[model samples]
Target chain A: MIRLEDIWRTFVMGDQSLHALQAVTETFAAGEHVAIIGPSGSGKSTLLNILGCLDKPTRGQYFFDGRAIESLDPDELAQLRLNEIGFIFQAFHLVPRLDATANIELPMTLAGVARKERSERARAALESVGLGDRAGHRPAELSGGQKQRVAIARAISMQPRLLLADEPTGNLDTHSGEQILDLLDGLNQEGITLAVVTHDPEVARRAQRVLEMRDGEIVRRISADEVSDANPIFDRGRVGKRP
Target chain B: MKPEDTFGYAVNALIQQPRRAGLSLLGVVIGVVAVIFLTALGEGARLYVTEQFQTLGTDVIVVIPGKTETTGMMPGFTGTPNDLTLDDAEALLRRIPEAILIAPISMGNDTVSYQNKSRQVVVLGSTPAFFELRGIPIARGSGLPEGDIDRGANVAVLGKETAEELFAEENPVGKSIRIGEWRIRVIGVNGPRGTHLGQNLDLVTIVPVATGMRMFNRTSLFRIMIELRPGSDIEAVKEKIEAVILDRHNEVDVTCMTPDAVIESLSAIVGTLTLVLVGIAAISLSVAGIGIMNVMLVAVSERRAEIGLLKAIGATHRQVLLVFLMESLLISTTGALVGLGIGFATIHVVTWMYPAMPAEAPIWAVFSVLALSVVAGVFFGVLPARRAMRLDPIIALSSKG
Candidate 1:
């Protein structure tokens, strides 16, 4: 579970004070599939970053599993992120020098996992993302879809309690995007809390709860039952169905 | 992290850029070669000169007229423009109790004729004790007798080389040889003393001092070579002799020297020359160290991404620093080994080529070279390694390169 109480984040850009996050309070319990949908500069990514412990809120309290994250040191925060949270970036920030397996095992290695066990777990994760045969291929040698799958494998390698994906399908083709969405859905079904931040309504529709934002503030929250699950596949053939 | 693991990573990183490592090592190689080669040359020259001095016996001292500096061209005569007459020699013999033998040597270049053969040679006039005093011996026939010296006899002892050149297979003893004006009998043939420095001792002829003075008729002075008694320290005897001579001559413008003091002065001059050579060699070493520094800086910049990735994966800043430092150290140490091999090979080749050359690499030179390589590595590596360690991981990961 994650909790935020009156969190405010501001940035100084030349002469102006820009508010990135404005006194927001929110909570997400375990096993929830959530999406924060907003236009650019609406603080959706900022909220996700805060939840993943990548950045700390300027004002107010953030509690992850009932512990105050604002009081933690940089090394402790890194440990929290390593042990309890996994991050997936839109650009897929994988170390280019490492092959897919090494990239997937990176988090485990950082956590001081035994070499043999780290390899075994990384292999299983890659298989889950359907990239078992491409374990030894570097990122440059892989396709866009395969790179995303490798990223997905790396994200889930540590079996973290929460998954934070900041536009996980933004750079992918429609089919690859659908496959990535389906993979997230499958992990959600296995009871891992998943938070996705995206601008696409279709991506938001796949989540069980959708929170829409405008101007650094959440404007609306829609439950899964309130939204129609109409298939957008017939409307846009380019946006294929999840496999 | 554990030291072993850190070392493994450092080794792997160095191997990844073999060309860069090799370039860095070139600096160390040049430094090592300069140190070893220059020092070997210095040591070799010193040994060669020392052995030449040793060939001249250590117990002998030469007393020349005039101060040594003032008598540059006339090293064997006093500056007063008067001969060191036979009376001076006799007076020195009586005054200096430490003097066991005093030889008044008169030398000049002349042609000696035996039958129809004639050759230019250096002729020396001395007493019978000259042979024993100067460590020269007769290899064939006999040396000049005391009677020959006392009676001013017209008798000569031919040097080994002179004997072979004039007489060939025939004995030269009891044969008449023409000096400048008079016919002198060849009483004995001298031994084979071989060449010392550049002077050939075997091409000389020895005659009585009185006969030489009468035949040449141009001597106001002669060189007084004194041999001290056995078991007496040469320095103490030299001081006593100098005091006795100064008292006899009223301490005016006279110069005396022990062979050991001459040798010491020569060694000091050689030692200064060695230092100058080492200084010139150090210039090359400094250039080499600069080359290493430049290459290491380039490596740091090129490996920025790898450094960031390592840091992101839990490597500490200290580990990163240590890795780069170790890479530099490895390169320098390898270069040192190569340079040492080259240095020893050069010494061996030179020794083989010139058997008479006494050049050798001492243990201290080898150790100093090794230590210098290590120091140079650390000195050139620290700057770039520190820069690499201080790089920010977040910005580094964000950069495209």
Candidate 2:
């Protein structure tokens, strides 16, 4: 479970201070799948970054599994991220030179898991993502879809309590994107809490609930069925599935 | 993380960019090679010079006229107070029971002629003990006969080259050569003796000290060489010789020097010269360190995305810094090893090519070079590693690598 109380993230540019997120309060329950939908610069990514512990809120109290995040030192925060959170990026963020298995084993390696266990877990994670045959293939050799799958494999390899995906399907073709979405939905079904930030309403449709953000504020919280009717941004043909 | 894991990652990172890693390490390689090769040369020269000094017996002490100043100015710069003569040499033998044999040397350049052939050569004047003291062997006939050094002998010992030049194919032992006004009979020919300290030993003609003193028309002897008995304390004997010279001349005007002292001073001078050369070579290692720094800085900037990714995967600041630091340390260590290999191989080739050059790197220099290279790599690595470690993950992750 996660809770954010009145989080504020501000960025100072020379003489001007810009508020990216203001008084944003939200939470996600255990084993729940939620989507945050917004246009560019709407603070969805910023909120996701804060939730992932990649960045700190300028002002807020954040609780992850009943532990206050703001009080943690840098190393403790790193440990927290290592043990409790898994992240997937739109660009797939796979180290280009490492094969699929090695990429999956990276986080565990950083966590000081023994070599034999690391390889075993890495192979198992790769199998879960249906990339068993691509274990030795580097990112450059994999399709965008396969790279995303590898990234997903890496995320779930640590068996985190929460998974955060930033536009997981943003760079993939429609068919592969659908497959990645299916894999993520399957992982969510297996009892890991999932939060996805996306512009695509189709992705938003897969989640149990949707949070619509605009102008650095969360304007509406709706169930998955209410996105098409209640949210106005997708009304302008942005809701249509990609060709 | 485990230290081996960190090591593995660093190795993998370097292996991923083989060309870049190789380029970064070249400076250290060259530095180490220069250090090893140049120090070997310096050490070899020192050894060669020391060996040359050792060829002269360590037990022999030479008394030269005039006192040498402590400032190392020319001897007798204050004044020419006394001339060391045969009498002073005999007095040293009488007063110091440690003296086993003494050779009073006198030298001059003059013309020697036998039949129609004539050549200018260095004519040395000394007792028969000169041959024994100098370790010269008689190849034919005999050395200067054991007789009174004060008595002028008409017999002469021709050097190997000097006899060959004057006699051609015929033996010159019984033949007589005219030196100015005196006809000196050749008693012996020295063996195949080579040059020492740039002096051509094989081109000199040896005669009795009194004969030389008469021929050069000089009243004072050139220098007196006293060979002490074995196991005799050289310093004690030197003091007694000085006392005898002082008693005879009324002033300590003679400079007493044992071959050990000369060899020691020479060894020290050469040793310092070797260190200076090594110092100059070590500067290259610093340059190599800077090269490592430059390459590491570039690597840090170029791999920002990877750094960010590592951080996102939960690498701490210390871990990130250590990874980068490991990279540089690996570069320098690998470079040092390659350099040492190349240096030793090249030295081997050099010694093979010229057997006379006893080229060998001193053990301390080899160890120092290894330590220096590692230090250079790690020292230069810190700045870039810190930069990489301190990078903001958000900014770094978003930047195009």
Candidate 3:
């Protein structure tokens, strides 16, 4: 489970402080599948980064499993990310120098896993993502969707309780993008909580819950029961019209 | 991560960048080879001088007339006011029982002629003790007979090479040779004594001291050579001889030198020369260190994405720093090992070229060079690794430049 209380993120350029995320609050229980949808600069990625423990909130607090993250040191935060949270970046941030299996094994290597066990678990992780045949391919050699799968395997190799995906299908074709979403949906049904940020409404259509962000704040929320009545894509079309 | 794992990673990265690693290695190898070969040259010169003096005799002392000043004023080939004589040498021989053999020397350059063959050679005049003190043995015929000091025999002894040149294959014993104008009969031919301190030992002729003084028209001996009894306290003998000479002459114009002093001074000079040469060689090692640092900094910049990925995977700032440092250690450690082999091979080549040069590097010098290379690697490794450690994961991950 995750909880955010008045979270804020500010960036200072020159003498000006830009509020990237402002006074955001939310909670998601275990096994809840959610999607954050908005146009560019809506603070959706910033909120997901805060949830993943990758970036600290500039104001207020975030709690994961009843533990406040703002009070933790850098080493403690790193431990939390290692064991409890997994992040899937829009860019599929797999190490270019490593093969698919080695890329998946990196998180466990940092966790002090034995070499033999790391290899075995890395192979299993690759198989789970339907990338077993591509274990020896580097990111440069892999297709975009294959690379994204390896990145996914790497993220979940440690069996984190929560997965935060930031525009996970942003760089893929429609077909592979569908495949990636199907894989993530299966992981969520298996009891791992998932949070996906996306501009594509089709990807948002399958979420159990949806949150719409604009101007550094969450402006709308649609639960599973009300999902069919609300069209988030139609809302984005209305916002672009001139008065 | 385990240390073995860290090392394995480091080795893998170095293998990926072979040209960069090899260029750094070249710097260290050149430095080490220079140090080994130059220092061995210095040691070889020291050993050569020590061996030459030892072969002469440890208890041998040579007393020359006139003081050798610390300034640029050396005792030249001119006669001194308080000249050393045969009587002064005899006085020291009589007083010190340790003085087992004393020979008075008179030397000059002359043209010795035989029928149609003539050559210019060094003519040395001394008693029979000269052969014992100078380590020369006669091959045939008798040496200078006893009691010849006062009688001044007109007998001549030819050096091996000199005898061969003037007589061809003929026997020179009992044969007469003309030295300037005086006719002397060859009494003996010295066996080959090779070369010492670059002077050919077998190109000289010898005669009795009294005859030499008459031939050169000089009364004072050029130098007095004394052979002390084996195991004699040379310092005590030197003091006693100086005291007797000072009493007879009443001046400190005389300089006495023992073989020990020569050897000690020679070693000191060689030691300093070796250090200076080794220091010059160390500059290359410093250059190598700087090269490693430059390459590592570029590596950090080029691999920023990889660094970001590792940090995301749970690597700490310290682990990132250690990885870069370990990479440098691998480079330098490999360089040092290869450099040592290069140095050793160079020494062998030098010894092979100059068989008698006696070049051998000290074990400590070899160990120190290896240690120096590793230290250079780690020392210069710090700056780049620190830069990598301080990098922000967010900025690094997003940076396309």
Task: Put down candidate 1 lDDT per residue, B272-336, tens digits, no spaces.
Answer: 97778667656666676777778778878877766664554445566678878877777777788
- Classified by CAPRI criteria, candidate 2 counts as acceptable
Model 3 interface CAPRI class: acceptable
Q: How close to the true structure is residue B319 of candidate 3, measured as C-alpha lDDT?
A: 77
Per-residue CA lDDT of model 1 for A118-208, tens digit only, reads: 8999999999999889999989999888898898888788788899887888788899999999999999999899999875666878898
Model 1 chain B TM at 0.86
Candidate maximizing DockQ: 2
lDDT of 1 at B389: 86
Candidate order (TM-score): 2, 3, 1
What local lDDT score does residue A196 receive in model 2, on the 0 to 100 scale? 95
Question: Per-candidate TM vs. native?
Answer: 0.72, 0.92, 0.88
Q: Pick by lDDT: which candidate is best?
A: 2
What's the distance in Å from true for residue A227, model 2? Answer: 1.9
Task: Report the C-alpha lDDT of model 3 over B62-101, residue by residue, as the tens digit.
Answer: 8878777633344544345477778887888899899889
RMSD values for the candidates in order, in angstroms, are 6.7, 3.6, 4.2
Tell me the lDDT of model 3 at B318.
74
- For every candidate, the chain B TM-score is 0.86, 0.90, 0.92
State each model's CA lDDT, in order: 0.76, 0.86, 0.82
